[model samples]
Target: LLQERQLIYDFMYKHKKTYSVGKICKYLKVSRNSYYHWKSVKLAKKKDSRRTVLVNEIKRIFKNSRQTYGSPRIQAELEKLGYKISRAYVARLIKAENIRFKPKKRFVNTTYSKHDYKIEKNTLDRQFKVEQLGKVWVSDITYIRVNDKWIYLTTMIDLADRQVVGWSLSKDMTYENTVLKAWNTARKRRQIIH
Candidate 1:
Protein backbone atom coordinates (compact mmCIF):
# COMPACT_ATOMS: atom_id res chain seq x y z
CA LEU A 1 0.00 0.00 0.00
CA LEU A 2 1.13 3.57 -0.49
CA GLN A 3 0.64 4.15 3.26
CA GLU A 4 3.27 1.51 3.99
CA ARG A 5 5.93 3.88 2.69
CA GLN A 6 4.48 6.61 4.87
CA LEU A 7 4.77 4.36 7.94
CA ILE A 8 8.35 3.55 7.15
CA TYR A 9 9.03 7.23 6.72
CA ASP A 10 7.59 7.78 10.19
CA PHE A 11 9.76 5.01 11.58
CA MET A 12 12.74 6.82 10.11
CA TYR A 13 11.57 10.16 11.48
CA LYS A 14 11.27 8.70 14.99
CA HIS A 15 14.86 7.53 14.78
CA LYS A 16 16.17 10.39 12.69
CA LYS A 17 18.44 11.41 15.55
CA THR A 18 20.33 8.11 15.28
CA TYR A 19 19.52 6.91 11.75
CA SER A 20 20.26 8.52 8.44
CA VAL A 21 17.08 9.84 6.77
CA GLY A 22 18.39 9.38 3.20
CA LYS A 23 19.24 5.70 3.75
CA ILE A 24 15.87 5.10 5.45
CA CYS A 25 13.88 6.65 2.60
CA LYS A 26 15.88 4.64 0.06
CA TYR A 27 15.41 1.40 1.94
CA LEU A 28 11.69 2.01 2.62
CA LYS A 29 10.97 2.91 -1.03
CA VAL A 30 9.57 6.28 -0.05
CA SER A 31 10.28 9.27 -2.22
CA ARG A 32 11.48 12.57 -0.77
CA ASN A 33 8.16 14.28 -1.59
CA SER A 34 6.24 11.41 -0.01
CA TYR A 35 8.36 11.57 3.12
CA TYR A 36 7.85 15.33 3.35
CA HIS A 37 4.09 15.00 2.98
CA TRP A 38 3.98 12.15 5.48
CA LYS A 39 6.04 14.26 7.86
CA SER A 40 3.33 16.96 7.73
CA VAL A 41 0.69 14.33 8.44
CA LYS A 42 2.67 13.00 11.43
CA LEU A 43 2.96 16.49 12.88
CA ALA A 44 -0.76 17.01 12.42
CA LYS A 45 -1.42 13.71 14.17
CA LYS A 46 0.64 14.79 17.17
CA LYS A 47 -1.42 17.95 17.48
CA ASP A 48 -4.63 16.03 16.92
CA SER A 49 -3.78 13.59 19.71
CA ARG A 50 -3.40 16.41 22.21
CA ARG A 51 -6.66 17.99 21.09
CA THR A 52 -8.39 14.63 21.24
CA VAL A 53 -7.24 14.03 24.79
CA LEU A 54 -8.35 17.49 25.83
CA VAL A 55 -11.74 17.05 24.24
CA ASN A 56 -12.25 13.64 25.83
CA GLU A 57 -11.22 14.88 29.25
CA ILE A 58 -13.56 17.81 28.85
CA LYS A 59 -16.40 15.48 27.94
CA ARG A 60 -15.70 13.20 30.92
CA ILE A 61 -15.49 16.01 33.43
CA PHE A 62 -18.55 17.62 31.92
CA LYS A 63 -20.48 14.37 32.24
CA ASN A 64 -19.27 13.78 35.79
CA SER A 65 -20.45 17.26 36.62
CA ARG A 66 -23.91 16.08 35.48
CA GLN A 67 -23.81 18.25 32.35
CA THR A 68 -24.28 21.32 34.53
CA TYR A 69 -20.76 22.68 34.06
CA GLY A 70 -19.82 25.17 31.36
CA SER A 71 -16.44 26.13 29.93
CA PRO A 72 -15.32 28.13 32.99
CA ARG A 73 -16.01 25.36 35.46
CA ILE A 74 -14.68 22.70 33.15
CA GLN A 75 -11.48 24.70 32.62
CA ALA A 76 -11.14 25.17 36.37
CA GLU A 77 -11.55 21.44 36.98
CA LEU A 78 -8.92 20.69 34.30
CA GLU A 79 -6.55 23.19 35.90
CA LYS A 80 -7.07 21.50 39.25
CA LEU A 81 -6.20 18.23 37.61
CA GLY A 82 -2.87 19.84 36.43
CA TYR A 83 -3.93 20.67 32.89
CA LYS A 84 -2.94 24.17 31.80
CA ILE A 85 -6.10 25.41 30.00
CA SER A 86 -7.94 28.66 29.68
CA ARG A 87 -11.67 29.32 29.70
CA ALA A 88 -11.55 30.57 26.12
CA TYR A 89 -9.68 27.46 25.06
CA VAL A 90 -12.22 25.29 26.85
CA ALA A 91 -15.03 27.19 25.16
CA ARG A 92 -13.39 26.65 21.78
CA LEU A 93 -12.91 22.95 22.49
CA ILE A 94 -16.56 22.54 23.53
CA LYS A 95 -17.68 24.39 20.41
CA ALA A 96 -15.51 22.21 18.20
CA GLU A 97 -17.07 19.13 19.78
CA ASN A 98 -20.56 20.61 19.34
CA ILE A 99 -21.16 20.13 23.08
CA ARG A 100 -23.53 22.29 25.06
CA PHE A 101 -23.46 22.46 28.87
CA LYS A 102 -26.33 23.61 31.09
CA PRO A 103 -26.07 26.97 32.80
CA LYS A 104 -25.17 26.50 36.46
CA LYS A 105 -27.83 27.35 38.99
CA ARG A 106 -27.66 27.73 42.76
CA PHE A 107 -27.67 24.48 44.69
CA VAL A 108 -31.03 23.55 46.19
CA ASN A 109 -31.65 20.74 48.66
CA THR A 110 -34.95 19.05 47.78
CA THR A 111 -34.82 16.37 50.47
CA TYR A 112 -37.33 16.44 53.32
CA SER A 113 -35.88 18.61 56.09
CA LYS A 114 -37.56 16.78 58.97
CA HIS A 115 -37.03 13.12 57.99
CA ASP A 116 -33.84 11.37 59.11
CA TYR A 117 -32.30 9.17 56.41
CA LYS A 118 -30.14 6.63 58.11
CA ILE A 119 -26.75 6.03 56.58
CA GLU A 120 -25.83 2.36 56.58
CA LYS A 121 -22.86 1.52 58.78
CA ASN A 122 -19.92 -0.24 57.22
CA THR A 123 -20.33 -3.66 58.85
CA LEU A 124 -17.74 -5.34 56.65
CA ASP A 125 -14.95 -3.20 58.16
CA ARG A 126 -12.59 -4.00 55.26
CA GLN A 127 -13.18 -7.72 55.89
CA PHE A 128 -13.79 -10.02 52.92
CA LYS A 129 -14.77 -13.02 54.96
CA VAL A 130 -18.33 -14.26 54.63
CA GLU A 131 -19.76 -17.44 56.14
CA GLN A 132 -22.83 -17.58 53.91
CA LEU A 133 -22.71 -17.99 50.14
CA GLY A 134 -25.23 -15.28 49.37
CA LYS A 135 -24.08 -12.83 52.06
CA VAL A 136 -21.51 -10.51 50.54
CA TRP A 137 -21.43 -9.60 46.87
CA VAL A 138 -18.86 -7.15 45.58
CA SER A 139 -19.34 -5.34 42.30
CA ASP A 140 -17.15 -3.20 40.09
CA ILE A 141 -17.25 -1.71 36.59
CA THR A 142 -14.38 -1.24 34.19
CA TYR A 143 -14.00 0.20 30.70
CA ILE A 144 -12.30 -1.79 27.97
CA ARG A 145 -11.39 -0.81 24.42
CA VAL A 146 -12.35 -3.12 21.59
CA ASN A 147 -10.93 -1.65 18.41
CA ASP A 148 -12.69 1.73 17.99
CA LYS A 149 -15.43 0.99 20.52
CA TRP A 150 -15.38 1.39 24.30
CA ILE A 151 -17.09 -1.32 26.34
CA TYR A 152 -18.07 -1.17 29.99
CA LEU A 153 -17.85 -4.45 31.85
CA THR A 154 -19.62 -4.83 35.20
CA THR A 155 -19.01 -7.91 37.31
CA MET A 156 -20.35 -9.01 40.66
CA ILE A 157 -18.69 -11.65 42.79
CA ASP A 158 -19.89 -13.43 45.89
CA LEU A 159 -17.19 -13.25 48.54
CA ALA A 160 -18.13 -16.52 50.17
CA ASP A 161 -18.46 -18.35 46.84
CA ARG A 162 -15.37 -16.56 45.53
CA GLN A 163 -16.88 -16.60 42.02
CA VAL A 164 -18.42 -14.19 39.56
CA VAL A 165 -22.13 -14.43 40.17
CA GLY A 166 -23.17 -12.04 37.45
CA TRP A 167 -21.77 -9.86 34.68
CA SER A 168 -22.99 -7.29 32.17
CA LEU A 169 -21.53 -5.30 29.31
CA SER A 170 -22.59 -2.06 27.67
CA LYS A 171 -21.23 0.56 25.32
CA ASP A 172 -21.27 3.31 27.93
CA MET A 173 -20.57 3.18 31.68
CA THR A 174 -24.11 3.52 33.02
CA TYR A 175 -25.62 2.09 36.22
CA GLU A 176 -28.71 0.80 34.41
CA ASN A 177 -26.69 -1.84 32.63
CA THR A 178 -23.81 -2.28 35.04
CA VAL A 179 -25.48 -1.99 38.42
CA LEU A 180 -29.14 -2.84 37.83
CA LYS A 181 -28.68 -5.79 35.49
CA ALA A 182 -25.72 -7.22 37.35
CA TRP A 183 -27.50 -6.85 40.68
CA ASN A 184 -30.61 -8.62 39.45
CA THR A 185 -28.60 -11.47 37.96
CA ALA A 186 -26.46 -11.80 41.07
CA ARG A 187 -29.54 -11.97 43.29
CA LYS A 188 -31.05 -14.72 41.15
CA ARG A 189 -27.85 -16.76 40.84
CA ARG A 190 -26.99 -16.49 44.51
CA GLN A 191 -30.56 -17.58 45.44
CA ILE A 192 -30.60 -16.01 48.86
CA ILE A 193 -33.41 -17.80 50.72
CA HIS A 194 -35.35 -14.85 52.01
Candidate 2:
Protein backbone atom coordinates (compact mmCIF):
# COMPACT_ATOMS: atom_id res chain seq x y z
CA LEU A 1 0.00 0.00 0.00
CA LEU A 2 2.86 2.41 0.83
CA GLN A 3 4.56 1.70 -2.50
CA GLU A 4 1.27 2.19 -4.36
CA ARG A 5 0.70 5.44 -2.48
CA GLN A 6 4.25 6.61 -3.34
CA LEU A 7 3.60 5.91 -7.03
CA ILE A 8 0.31 7.79 -6.89
CA TYR A 9 1.95 10.72 -5.09
CA ASP A 10 4.73 10.86 -7.71
CA PHE A 11 2.20 10.84 -10.56
CA MET A 12 0.09 13.55 -8.95
CA TYR A 13 3.16 15.72 -8.22
CA LYS A 14 4.23 15.39 -11.85
CA HIS A 15 0.80 16.52 -13.13
CA LYS A 16 -0.78 18.42 -10.20
CA LYS A 17 -2.66 20.79 -12.56
CA THR A 18 -4.58 17.87 -14.16
CA TYR A 19 -4.60 15.21 -11.36
CA SER A 20 -5.66 15.74 -7.70
CA VAL A 21 -5.32 13.57 -4.55
CA GLY A 22 -9.01 12.64 -4.77
CA LYS A 23 -8.63 11.63 -8.41
CA ILE A 24 -5.51 9.48 -7.67
CA CYS A 25 -7.17 7.84 -4.65
CA LYS A 26 -10.21 6.90 -6.78
CA TYR A 27 -7.91 5.51 -9.51
CA LEU A 28 -5.97 3.41 -6.93
CA LYS A 29 -9.26 2.20 -5.30
CA VAL A 30 -8.16 3.59 -1.91
CA SER A 31 -9.81 6.09 0.45
CA ARG A 32 -8.63 9.74 0.57
CA ASN A 33 -7.83 9.41 4.28
CA SER A 34 -5.58 6.39 3.61
CA TYR A 35 -3.82 8.25 0.83
CA TYR A 36 -3.20 11.26 3.09
CA HIS A 37 -1.90 9.05 5.88
CA TRP A 38 0.50 7.26 3.50
CA LYS A 39 1.61 10.65 2.13
CA SER A 40 2.37 11.97 5.64
CA VAL A 41 4.58 9.07 6.65
CA LYS A 42 8.14 9.10 5.28
CA LEU A 43 9.06 6.00 3.29
CA ALA A 44 11.91 4.06 4.90
CA LYS A 45 14.59 2.32 2.86
CA LYS A 46 13.89 -1.32 1.89
CA LYS A 47 15.08 -4.06 4.28
CA ASP A 48 18.24 -5.99 3.42
CA SER A 49 17.68 -8.95 1.06
CA ARG A 50 20.32 -11.09 2.85
CA ARG A 51 17.72 -12.34 5.37
CA THR A 52 16.30 -14.74 2.76
CA VAL A 53 19.68 -16.35 2.31
CA LEU A 54 20.13 -16.72 6.09
CA VAL A 55 16.65 -18.24 6.47
CA ASN A 56 17.41 -20.74 3.72
CA GLU A 57 20.63 -21.74 5.48
CA ILE A 58 18.74 -22.15 8.76
CA LYS A 59 16.14 -24.34 7.04
CA ARG A 60 18.95 -26.42 5.54
CA ILE A 61 20.41 -26.95 9.00
CA PHE A 62 17.02 -28.00 10.34
CA LYS A 63 16.51 -30.50 7.50
CA ASN A 64 20.05 -31.88 7.87
CA SER A 65 19.41 -32.46 11.58
CA ARG A 66 16.34 -34.56 10.62
CA GLN A 67 14.03 -31.71 11.63
CA THR A 68 14.78 -32.40 15.29
CA TYR A 69 16.32 -29.02 16.14
CA GLY A 70 14.30 -26.21 17.63
CA SER A 71 15.13 -22.49 17.54
CA PRO A 72 17.92 -22.62 20.14
CA ARG A 73 19.70 -25.56 18.55
CA ILE A 74 19.33 -24.05 15.12
CA GLN A 75 20.72 -20.74 16.42
CA ALA A 76 23.68 -22.57 17.99
CA GLU A 77 24.42 -24.36 14.74
CA LEU A 78 24.24 -21.04 12.88
CA GLU A 79 26.65 -19.47 15.38
CA LYS A 80 29.08 -22.39 14.85
CA LEU A 81 29.25 -21.28 11.19
CA GLY A 82 30.01 -17.66 12.34
CA TYR A 83 26.45 -16.47 11.70
CA LYS A 84 25.77 -13.93 14.46
CA ILE A 85 21.98 -14.15 14.14
CA SER A 86 19.84 -13.91 17.27
CA ARG A 87 17.70 -16.81 18.60
CA ALA A 88 14.62 -14.58 18.47
CA TYR A 89 15.34 -13.87 14.82
CA VAL A 90 15.58 -17.59 14.10
CA ALA A 91 12.31 -18.21 15.94
CA ARG A 92 10.58 -15.44 14.00
CA LEU A 93 11.93 -16.79 10.73
CA ILE A 94 10.66 -20.29 11.54
CA LYS A 95 7.26 -18.97 12.52
CA ALA A 96 6.94 -16.75 9.44
CA GLU A 97 7.92 -19.68 7.22
CA ASN A 98 5.49 -22.02 9.08
CA ILE A 99 8.25 -24.58 9.53
CA ARG A 100 7.91 -27.13 12.37
CA PHE A 101 9.57 -30.36 13.48
CA LYS A 102 7.69 -33.62 13.76
CA PRO A 103 7.24 -35.15 17.21
CA LYS A 104 8.57 -38.62 18.11
CA LYS A 105 6.17 -41.58 18.27
CA ARG A 106 5.11 -42.99 21.63
CA PHE A 107 6.25 -46.44 22.80
CA VAL A 108 3.52 -49.07 23.09
CA ASN A 109 3.23 -51.80 25.69
CA THR A 110 3.02 -55.38 24.32
CA THR A 111 2.14 -57.51 27.36
CA TYR A 112 -0.77 -59.99 26.97
CA SER A 113 -1.78 -61.97 30.10
CA LYS A 114 -4.82 -63.71 28.55
CA HIS A 115 -3.97 -67.34 27.67
CA ASP A 116 -5.47 -70.87 28.03
CA TYR A 117 -2.38 -72.32 29.70
CA LYS A 118 -3.00 -72.81 33.44
CA ILE A 119 -1.76 -69.64 35.04
CA GLU A 120 0.07 -70.22 38.30
CA LYS A 121 -1.45 -68.29 41.17
CA ASN A 122 0.37 -65.09 42.08
CA THR A 123 2.38 -66.92 44.83
CA LEU A 124 4.40 -63.87 45.69
CA ASP A 125 1.28 -61.67 45.38
CA ARG A 126 2.43 -58.03 45.84
CA GLN A 127 5.03 -58.90 48.50
CA PHE A 128 7.93 -57.54 46.46
CA LYS A 129 9.98 -56.24 49.40
CA VAL A 130 12.15 -59.07 50.71
CA GLU A 131 14.87 -59.09 53.44
CA GLN A 132 17.49 -60.83 51.23
CA LEU A 133 18.23 -60.47 47.50
CA GLY A 134 17.42 -64.11 46.57
CA LYS A 135 14.65 -64.67 49.10
CA VAL A 136 11.66 -64.46 46.72
CA TRP A 137 11.48 -64.82 42.95
CA VAL A 138 8.50 -63.73 40.85
CA SER A 139 7.88 -64.87 37.28
CA ASP A 140 5.55 -63.61 34.56
CA ILE A 141 5.07 -64.30 30.84
CA THR A 142 4.30 -61.64 28.24
CA TYR A 143 3.92 -61.50 24.49
CA ILE A 144 5.71 -59.13 22.11
CA ARG A 145 4.40 -58.14 18.71
CA VAL A 146 7.36 -58.35 16.36
CA ASN A 147 6.83 -57.87 12.61
CA ASP A 148 3.07 -58.44 13.09
CA LYS A 149 3.75 -61.84 14.71
CA TRP A 150 3.45 -62.71 18.41
CA ILE A 151 6.56 -63.79 20.31
CA TYR A 152 6.24 -64.99 23.92
CA LEU A 153 8.66 -63.79 26.60
CA THR A 154 8.97 -65.14 30.17
CA THR A 155 10.92 -63.29 32.82
CA MET A 156 11.87 -64.20 36.39
CA ILE A 157 12.38 -61.19 38.62
CA ASP A 158 13.96 -61.18 42.06
CA LEU A 159 11.42 -59.55 44.39
CA ALA A 160 14.11 -58.11 46.66
CA ASP A 161 15.90 -55.89 44.15
CA ARG A 162 13.33 -56.15 41.33
CA GLN A 163 16.11 -57.40 39.07
CA VAL A 164 15.38 -59.61 36.06
CA VAL A 165 17.30 -62.72 37.12
CA GLY A 166 16.33 -64.60 33.96
CA TRP A 167 14.32 -64.15 30.77
CA SER A 168 13.43 -66.28 27.71
CA LEU A 169 11.71 -65.31 24.49
CA SER A 170 10.06 -67.88 22.20
CA LYS A 171 7.66 -68.07 19.27
CA ASP A 172 5.32 -70.41 21.21
CA MET A 173 3.48 -69.63 24.48
CA THR A 174 2.99 -73.16 25.79
CA TYR A 175 3.47 -74.83 29.20
CA GLU A 176 6.88 -76.11 28.07
CA ASN A 177 7.90 -72.57 27.16
CA THR A 178 6.94 -71.26 30.62
CA VAL A 179 8.68 -74.16 32.42
CA LEU A 180 11.82 -73.89 30.32
CA LYS A 181 12.11 -70.16 31.06
CA ALA A 182 11.72 -70.85 34.82
CA TRP A 183 14.33 -73.62 34.67
CA ASN A 184 16.76 -71.46 32.77
CA THR A 185 16.24 -68.61 35.23
CA ALA A 186 16.92 -70.89 38.20
CA ARG A 187 20.01 -72.36 36.49
CA LYS A 188 21.39 -68.90 35.70
CA ARG A 189 20.86 -67.71 39.28
CA ARG A 190 22.18 -71.04 40.65
CA GLN A 191 19.00 -71.39 42.69
CA ILE A 192 18.29 -74.93 43.94
CA ILE A 193 14.50 -74.40 44.12
CA HIS A 194 12.85 -75.68 40.88
- Check candidate 2 and list the clashing pairs: none
Clashes of each: 0, 0
Tens digit of per-residue lDDT, candidate 2, span 101-183 = 86644777666678788887877777767978677877788867675488888888777778788788888877677757665
Candidate with maximal lDDT: 1
How far off is model 2, as Cα RMSD? 12.7
| TM-score (C-alpha, index-matched) for candidate 1 | 0.43
Among residues 3 or more apart in sequence or in different chains, the pairs in candidate 1 whose N, CA or C atoms overlap within 3 Å are: none
Instruction: Give TM-scores for every candidate, taking all chains together and pairing residue i with residue i.
Output: 0.43, 0.37
- Which tens-of-lDDT digit does each residue in 12-114 have in candidate 1? 8889999777887787666877778878888999989999999999999998877879998899999998999889999999998999876755666645657
Q: What is the C-alpha lDDT of each candidate?
A: 0.84, 0.76
Overall local distance difference test of candidate 1: 0.84
What's the C-alpha lDDT at position 89 in model 2?
91
* Off by more than 4 A, model 2: 1-66, 76-84, 91-100, 107-121, 131-135, 139-156, 160-164, 167-186
